[model samples]
Target chain A: MGDIQAIAKQFTDFYYSTFDSNRSALQAVYRPTSMLTWEGSPILGATDITEKLVSLPFEKVQHKVTTFDAQPSSPTIASILVSVTGLLLVDDSPNPLQFSQIFHLIPDAGSYYVYNDVFRLNYG
Target chain B: MGDIQAIAKQFTDFYYSTFDSNRSALQAVYRPTSMLTWEGSPILGATDITEKLVSLPFEKVQHKVTTFDAQPSSPTIASILVSVTGLLLVDDSPNPLQFSQIFHLIPDAGSYYVYNDVFRLNYG
Candidate 1:
């Protein structure tokens, strides 16, 4: 089995860094067969999902990971669950959003690709 | 706003009861448009997802929820994030699995239905 904890931390760092700086680079992390659930809506394929990410209505965002857990799904795949608390500056107003996201990372060409992703914001 | 904590507890009770007894009874909690991501694979539509649940390899399983958090997504919809540790009797062997699941619940009539559901087991 793979060292899931190490992968989780690495993924968190790489993912959020790309998200904050150059979301377009995320294209390399997802494939054509990938799936994303943003909040409750399902967006299929890598192109559509990346577009959605870049178009998020936030001027600036920062994510703080609270919990990072992982499990190996297959010999070459790992599943990770992450809980995050973040601040988003939208329309010059800063708001906090607590969310949990899941990622199914599949190994290919010595790197990992996001095969499945689900993100939901917690609001009361 | 609705009492999210109360609803989370109530949902836990109702969901596991039906899961332990009559898995078919889950029809009332999902609609034809419902979508489910089991582990990593996405199963669309309620009928297909229900079949997948009933056909799980375990003869008997139990879920013990450790954390239950809920946030209202819209006036009539709520988003819940739950972390569960559970045991499953598969192939006459008992094994424990830690998992995190997210549910997007939409209210219809007087009750709520799962609009989108994602479940992934944490393994290392």
Candidate 2:
């Protein structure tokens, strides 16, 4: 349980920092079978997903995580279900958009990669 | 892939409806090891989690799903990752709050159950 929390914290910190600094670098976290749903549009594979992310309208972006929760998915499958709520600033925008994201991370060779990812902007 | 979408839709619809109408009925979808993080607080197991859900401050609540995304977690594990964004109405309040939730559904004996759930309010 402590290990789960620690990895969750470390993963979130690394994820957001990498996203803010270099969007393309996120490809390391995905695989060929990975799927990413960005604003309801599904993108498959690591390269295509990374391209979709890099093609977003914003040149600069920052994510401030408000809260996150992580849990082991199944007893048989070695995976982590992580959910995050955050505020996002894009392209130097003064107003930050509240967002929600979920990442299904699967174990690889001594590491983890995103198997499923979903991102949404929570707007009223 | 198509089955994943259909199941995701059915699950979310049934979930929020059951949540609004009869919160206790949700226990069927949870197991002993299931975990729910509601508003950043972790609730473990079906009975305790259902109790926590039923004990929320509001007597009446409704969830209006804005968008949802789903993906299969792994080729070996028969599970789906479902993420949802929605507007939430508590009681008779006119101002609705936006919320984001993720559900990790794992297949059981000819059925599916909630293995992990995370809920967060997207407040600015």
Candidate 3:
């Protein structure tokens, strides 16, 4: 249970910290098989998603996690609910957005890794 | 795409309506194979979830869906984002709660059915 919480925290932390700039930290959390489907159309795997993020002009973004729900179905499988409010620096303008992220976590090589993540973007 | 939106709306409507008192309506949306995970420990299937819901004393509830995002991944598969605010009458006390529900839709026979649904309850 504790381990799952830690893993869940790690995921949100990585999302807030690395989603905008830190490439290495982002790489650390996502498995090679990881895939993201955004707005229901674009289906991109780990490498593509990372490339897309890196190519963007987002200089800084801060995520405030309002609620974090973690459930460990098994010792190796965990689910997380991460609700966030983000302050994005878009063209030097502050764009505030609310988002909810769901993560499916799995243990790999004795360490927990994010298997898949689905997110919904909300406008403020 | 339109079909998925309609199905997603049906889901929210059913949840807001039957989750309180209408047992038959509750049975309509959920399949026998459906299962729900609340908090972390409990794993109850459709029948058990319905029974538990029926035992509650909730008289009336109204759900306002703020944002409904639906994406048809394929002709037979779809995804939805349903963010809702509910007014619940609990012992004659008004309880307002914000919740976000995600639904994965699949076509069964000739109609669409929810494969899995995950929700997060937010207290205001």
Candidate 4:
């Protein structure tokens, strides 16, 4: 069996390191064929997902990974939770919006990468 | 150290045992002084939280715990994620709501229980 803790740590580290405008790092942690579904709509693959993340209309948005959880499957497939707080750049906007996101990750070659992710925005 | 996998299992088992009208089981897994914060407001202890969950204006509601993760702390403290899908019973209502909940849990004696849980409803 794989080291579930180590895999979980790696997953969270990669997730936090690429949050916000870190497009290059984001590219590294996600599989090329990765898909992100937001609000129940399929948003295509990693490149498109990256583009969508970067294209959000924010002057200085910030993403903070608040918590991470993972369950190891085999040596490759793992389920992960990458909770986040996204701070909008709009001056009059409220504080960071809280989101709890789940990612199904798979190890590719020597590196671990996200395979599928879904974000749920918290609003009571 | 406690078996992380076992701990994770126990936590999730307790979480899903009473997702809908099963108030008795819900009352079991949570700490007596547990606090649940919906959105940003503090909702007091487990009794209050259970009351709120049961009082939802739905004819038939169901809660399903999709995934679980835990990091053990000492013999008492652990961080848990109880990802969920909540189905509303209202006519013409949406299928189910997706939520990723992060929980701070503590083991009392031998049983694991949730201490603090925050739910983030995923819309987008």
Residue B14 shift from truth in candidate 4, angstroms: 16
DockQ (CA atoms), all models: 0.05, 0.88, 0.16, 0.09
The 10 consecutive residues of candidate 1 chain B with the worst lDDT sum are B81-90
| lDDT for B22 (candidate 1) | 76
DockQ ranking, best first: 2, 3, 4, 1
In model 4, what are the clashing residue pairs, if there are any? A120-B122, A121-B122
Using lDDT as the measure, the top candidate is: 2
Q: Could you give candidate 4's per-residue lDDT for residues B1-124 as a string of tens digits?
A: 2476576666666665556547545766665567665654456567888887666666555556554444332222343333443432343466666566666555568666666566655543
Docking class of 2: high
**Model 2 error, position B53 (Å):** 1.2
Each candidate: fraction of true contacts kept? Answer: 0.00, 1.00, 0.00, 0.10
Lowest lDDT sum, 10 consecutive residues, model 1 chain A, at A74-83
Name the regions of candidate 2 deviating beyond 4 angstroms. none
Candidate 3 residues lying further than 4 Å off, grouped into runs, are A20-24, A73-95, B1-17, B20-59, B62-98, B103-118, B121-124
- The regions of model 4 sitting more than 4 angstroms off are A74-94, B1-18, B22-124
Top of the candidates by DockQ:
2
Specify the poorest-scoring 10-residue window by lDDT in model 4 chain A.
A72-81
| Superposed model 1: Cα runs more than 4 Å off | A75-92, B1-15, B18-124
Scored against the native two-chain complex, candidate 4 gets a DockQ of 0.09
